[model samples]
Target: MTTTAVDPAKCRRCHRALTSAKSIATGYGPGCAAKIRGAAKTADLTDFKPAQIAKATELIEQGGILRTRRPNLYTAVSGDGNTTYLVARQACTCPAGIKNRACYHRAALTILAAA
Candidate 1:
């Protein structure tokens, strides 16, 4: 049996009532998740190109699948192939994603190719 964080409150840093927690990342109430998710969206403007974004997205998916049995299957990174990270429902494997407001693989493939 696997147990990944589900309720938002279990997350490390969320201030509102949480409804859903998918992956090791915590989700906030509509107010917070929207804001954070938005920040994650804006993060793509930094430097990565569309191709890199797609690769990153694919890493997350592969990591997600690798983590499918997590909270029980032994935590592992769900994004990026370089580093294998410890993941929970409220946290991610990469420092960039954890340190500050960063984009989830959710926006990975969506980054503008022109950017």
Candidate 2:
């Protein structure tokens, strides 16, 4: 009689022990999964909203516009320090800020505008 069993040392990618729990491609035990999940909380996406990310991306891509509500805001940059651009609320001047929705500058701008 033959019994089927999973090899612990086999890695789906390199056929070795998947040391990095981030390798979701190759599944490990539940404990490993849980550990990875805990490590990647923001990426878990249990309540992920694609629309929100899309909207943020759009806002960033559109860039910021100077408005009467918030003065002294910066949008785009130039070699000259005098060349200041007013950024619209929640707008980011970075690609990652637009696509990945991870712009610290945008966040800072928003906070400053709010305050």
Candidate 3:
């Protein structure tokens, strides 16, 4: 399952208590954030639209996409930063996805897999 409202004092990935102010602010520990960034560096955005690619990159860089406890499942923050959606291998639980349309969250998933 994906965690939507993450606690500021815990790591998003491992749910471990976070002591560092930076980690708490970002919702991820230093190591986990580094891993996400490293993965994003290698993601291929050739097939997606420029806007999608840019958004996907931004999600990774800003810690908007978070790995859930389940394999192949993730939680992505909405563009307005007001909501989080569950993303799986084949589908995402976002509005665009609900209508069977594409969304940047899927592209973010591809980026996350590199980690």
Most lDDT-accurate candidate: 3
lDDT of 2 by residue, 62-86 (tens): 3322234445545543223344444
Task: Please give each candidate's TM-score.
Answer: 0.32, 0.26, 0.64
1-115, model 3: which lDDT tens digit per residue? 8879865487766778999877877777888888877766667755567688779878866788877789888999999999999998568899988987668898888776766
lDDT of 2 at 110: 40
Off by over 4 Å in 1: 1-8, 19-26, 51-76, 79-83, 86-115
- Stretches of candidate 3 off by over 4 Å are 1-8, 60-63, 66-71, 82-84, 98-101
Please identify which of the two predictions, 2 or 3, would achieve the higher TM-score against the true structure: 3
Off by over 4 Å in 2: 1-73, 76-86
lDDT of 1 at 79: 42
Regarding TM-score, does 1 or 3 come out ahead?
A: 3
Quote the positional error of residue 111 for candidate 1 in Å.
12
lDDT of 1 by residue, 1-115 (tens): 9989765353222445544555235322445435444544565445555654555445433433233443422244444444555433334455654774343432342321111
Ranking by TM-score: 3, 1, 2
Q: What is candidate 2's local distance difference test score? A: 0.40
